[model samples]
Target: MSSEVVRFEASEEFARRMDAEDSLRSFREEFLFPVHDGEPAIYFVGNSLGLQPRKAKTYVLEALEDWEKLGVEGHFRGTRPWMPYHEMLTEQTARLVGAHPIEVVVMNTLSVNLHLMMVSFYQPTRERPKILMEAGAFPSDQYAVASQVRFHGYDPDKDILRLAPREGEETLRTEDILDTIERHGREIALVLLGNVNYLTGQAFDMAAITRAAHKQGCRVGFDLAHGAGNLQLSLHDDGPDFAVWCSYKYLNGGPGTLGGVFVHERHAHNKALPRFAGWWGHDKQTRFQMGPDFEPIPGAEGWLLSNPPIFQLAALRASLELFDRATMPALRRKSDRLTAYLEFLLDRLPPGVVRITTPRDPKQRGAQLSLRFSKDPRRLLEKLNSAGVHCDFRSPDIIRAAPAPLYNSFHDVYRFVGVLERHARD
Candidate 1:
């Protein structure tokens, strides 16, 4: 249902009724929630760390059992062998980000994958030596980009271009982004952006940005840390050189789990491309031969620098099964409605008590709603936690509350708003 057609009511009965009518409500039972008092806490922090999936333990145990029984032989003997285990995630990971299986691979952590991608794609020359990125990006990304530029013997202050929102604006305008690319395209060797900005919950026009960057002979990539499971992405159609994301947040892969990478199919068989190689990324047919030369496997797997952690892969596999069953289209549909309902309820608060930093249009965001409070946001966060509303506080004032459609119900959103209302009144 579109937001314009449905008029939302702010009563407890309304919230329960919506939850009752939800098609995806059963999926909520699959996850384990944190307890507040005796009841399940109102979990709206999926944008940070997602709740653990109940099946994760079972999956991990299967791996452990195999390891104990077969030892080194488990590499080739188990139901899901350790040797080609990462391949098991390729198709599902591709579907999640809308890419070909050949283009996707499950491997190292997000930053590690990001640095690997930059090594090949961020080939800065004397004429075009700059890296373009969003201002106020996540600190990790800022540090990564700065260090990359410095490693190439370029001064980050001189070579890195950080784009910011206009004066007094909380989010970026798409037109301005395109204009900047048009003007600076010649000097930029690469353009890296968060597919969805972590702070303001702003989703960018990635396709447009990619096209603009390509027109200027610049390679483009995205950090999908907030976008992967939360947004319905079309990375292949969008035509970015590469993209990377972690599985711990919206993906529910447990804490500090594995990450994924997408490399466009056009570059799949380019063995001459410079990369940090490892034995695992070698061609399967001759990998056991222990050849001195690295005959890199075609596509995204070719970028792997080491063998992955099997336990983390097992944990992520459990969540990917849920995603495959739930489907991004269905999840995205419910996410829009849930976020709209949250916005409607937040709008009812007294003027100047709070301001939403996220875009009002659902097209421009994911499940997260960033709330900027007029009062002590940290104190309010403490009250919300005490009252069984679980969310996260960013520095200064913003509180990011994400109602994950796979687990969070409309009633959860309602109860959360009720707590915020009481605190605002106080």
Candidate 2:
């Protein structure tokens, strides 16, 4: 926390003043904002899908041109050679997650990488076959873990243990999570959790959880779908056995783009570890030989299944360049202030109208704030959308809004709250 005080007020003028003072404000011009009523809408849904960078089109077009100019030779002689295209993203991706270049790789989608990581890290013996995880995890994670357990000849109902929040609570307590790990230490083989809860916007202490799980002799991993570009994480220092994340969210890669993975350097050269083999995962020097013997590439690249997707990687590179110029430490500083300002404004709304489900503590969350409304939130969100507030709504009662540090402005948050307040009065 800086000594400089942030006194939030419920006025548009105050919002403009903050925006003027924000050093990162100019970066907002780089994105393509959604238009509503012939003006840029207040977009607060970066947690679901990020706004496209204006440079993405140019990058993709460059790749398209290279492919057209050079046919088969493009693999080795393109503007950015297709053969080693993913290598261009490795350093930036690693820096974003606080990992070494050898430990990070951009490959398959989130679910596919989760399954691939499980193949190597989730070995279960007769005595310790259970997998532990947070209850109410994203549906994709829940399904992936359950299906993996079933594939390994274990019943998901008996082998998968889900830790839930206490009755009447909206989020899990760190103490509770540790205590559960202690109590179930013997039967657990692996502990997998989403670093930031998608629905509640609660960020977990990954290092602490990893320490606790490792103490209990359990292998741990994270689904960083919401944490990757939103929070400052030290994946290598956190010491999880492996972690996976989608690039489409805060990473601002285009929709359904490729995902990222991190494997601890301790396992980087371990050839004995079991993994599903692929041509791309073969040793790069000998890969063209096409030998029948499976020679795994050391580190996270060993998990890749196919050649890189050039267009998607090109778009991702554009976003990464913006992030490089902005830098993580600065973005995180602005993110903390932006989310805090959102909480401040929401607290001033009429009593009992809406409740914030995400934690108030900066350490426990990222840029997103999930609101649980008193009435049917679906209708409320629809009304907000009609007013040009482009946030996301979950089933039943929650609305998730995120003021992305890279593009969103303080004025945007102010306008979103104003729409919600007017909708409540209506």
Candidate 3:
């Protein structure tokens, strides 16, 4: 279908009516929004900085109070203490990724966790030391991979392999990925890919990619920064060796928060595996003994470098509790409908004015829609910002807008589309 062919009157009044009837409408009131021109700004930036949950403050305050009262004894003294804090959240996060509690652990930031995972899984023999990743991975991940290869005394410029979309294709096809893995399997030590690409919102096929990599004796890992809370992950069934994700984007854990890393159960008992560790990763019983030698714990916790920030965990705990209520299936249903509605409205725009670059199939994407304006990208973004319709612009051409189902209603999307059409037309 063409942009000019679709019919829908996306207007403020229409949006308000939709909100009034939406089942998830009440959630919009729970998040803090940017104020522009003395009114709450439309927040389409959840893919970058998720809107803060009201309960986040309460959770952090409780942790603060615990710190104030318990002091040095706070490790086991408070209600949600320093001890066993991250473990408390493992089960819920595992459910989000469809894995066992032993397979998942919330730990350091995404890049850090990726580095730690690489230490264990990216063991490259001289014959097969090259690491394979997307061509335009988020800069942080690129840096982590390069630094890791360098740390191993290998030159990243020659050893790192990059996979780009085929000529003239904006997004990569699944067949190309499988072909690359099969062709280079023996020389490829690891395949680290994004579950949902950050720029194009193209969701990759995890199960197939894992299978192809495994067939060639190459281990696989995923950088799920955009996938974690937005899509249903078959982490256990797909069986990647390891994976990492940030909580702040879709998990609503707060800025620069700790994140999750998954180590498949098969690797859980591999005591011979190489790992960079900390006192927390030591046997909890022997940790306080302050021994000279380090014995690692089993599973994901064995990769921990230190105890995580409890304040961040507190926020994650509250957010995961909400997930337990909404469940992935319920949120996905709303995501599909709301995003389709947004696409329908945007398609009503003038021909060639706005293009929906995100995949059309509901099964191929998450909640985000990335748009390309044939006009000046910066001007279009500023125009929306001035109109009180908040959205984000990825440099060059694409603007990413996410109608988060947990707190975003159908009307918010309707209003955003209405504002976009008016501005793009005027």
Candidate 4:
């Protein structure tokens, strides 16, 4: 499953042959690609918002019909039983992230989940009252950590440590990160980071980072908004204290769908951990008793605040079913190849036009390849849009493209490169 450049060629015939050989080719038809100029789009932005699954409508409609027919009884009498609807997704979601059902739950959106996890995990003491995180984390993560520290009466400037890449470097080194953890060992109360950097598409070593943080007697958590479905995660084995992610990107759930959270099983029964409690988190047996005492359901379910939206869960379940069938291992095999093919073709473009910011090693990244150009990519992005190459432009000069293994093909990558090459030439 190595992405050896020697086996690649820069030709349409080569792309077509690769597509013909790809075992995942049929999955492409399972999604609905956007149309541009009366043709299917060359969609490569799955890292941002994945293409909608053709089955999403079917799933949504089922829930709608259930609601209409059963009314409030849908809670207990519907086909899937709305009262336990979130349970249907637990095992599958856990499998996707390599965790047990007891450790995973689908609940609030990504940021809210982050806040909930921190409430339990980020217990800053007077002796060790600092948070260490990568510099330039997504703004939402930055805001969450900043506000959390402020709520505890600590100044973010003094209490938050931002780890940046070395001078003249674009990505952080594992050694630098470890060294930072060691240097700030005593002061650090928590270590937080995005498992995969959204802008650069650089996937961090979560296991290594978690081990280092634990060695320093610090709690560690990760924002997996980009890494969840794109990377092969072993949350339980990796030993991160907690993790959070949204379902829209590589998970292919509809826009603004439910997010997920992971809590290490070790903390499952720690009733002393602080959390914002709600009725849904109460014990299932006593939840309807109108009891005065709040007894949380053990494990990740304890953090849930409200009954999940059935329709959103339905959409996500539709996408997760696809992942269950394709399986991460098989998807990773094609993802490596599709991304390698994309890299191969991008390399053939004229020099000094665009530079890859993502790590070159396949093991160090997922399906995305971020291109930094010499000038603003806005005009070129517009041209790509008109040409039916669906991708996105970040501020200033970077363009991000992800060849999602579930539905994207080598031909899509090839056509995308052809359009980008023409734009670069002009």
- Full-model lDDT for every candidate: 0.92, 0.92, 0.86, 0.89
Write the residue-wise lDDT of candidate 1 on 1-426 in tens digits: 332456689999999988887888999999999998898999999888998999999999999999999999888998689988988999999999999999999989999999999999999999999999998799999999999999999999999999999999989999998999999999999999999999999999999999999999999999999999999999999999999999999999989999999999999999877788888888889988987999999999888878889999999999999999999998999999899999999999899988999999889999999999888889999989889888999976799999999999999989999889999666
By lDDT: ranked, best first: 1, 2, 4, 3
Candidate RMSDs in Å, in order, are 1.2, 1.2, 3.3, 1.4
Please list the residue runs of candidate 3 whose C-alpha ends up more than 4 Å from where it truly belongs after superposition.
Answer: 1-23, 36-39
Which ten-residue region of model 1 has the weakest summed lDDT? 1-10
True-vs-predicted CA distance for residue 404, candidate 4, Å? 0.6
Clashes of each: 0, 0, 0, 0
Worst 10 residues of 4 by lDDT: 1-10
* lDDT by residue (tens digit), candidate 4, 10-63: 888888888887777788888998888787889888988988888989888988
Candidate 2 residues lying further than 4 Å off, grouped into runs, are 1-3
Model 4: how large is the Cα RMSD against the reference? 1.4
lDDT of 4: 0.89
Better of 3 and 4 by TM-score: 4
The ten-residue window of minimal lDDT in model 3 covers 1-10
- Cα error, residue 264 of model 3, in Å, equals 0.7
User: Residue 24 of candidate 4: its Cα lDDT?
Assistant: 71
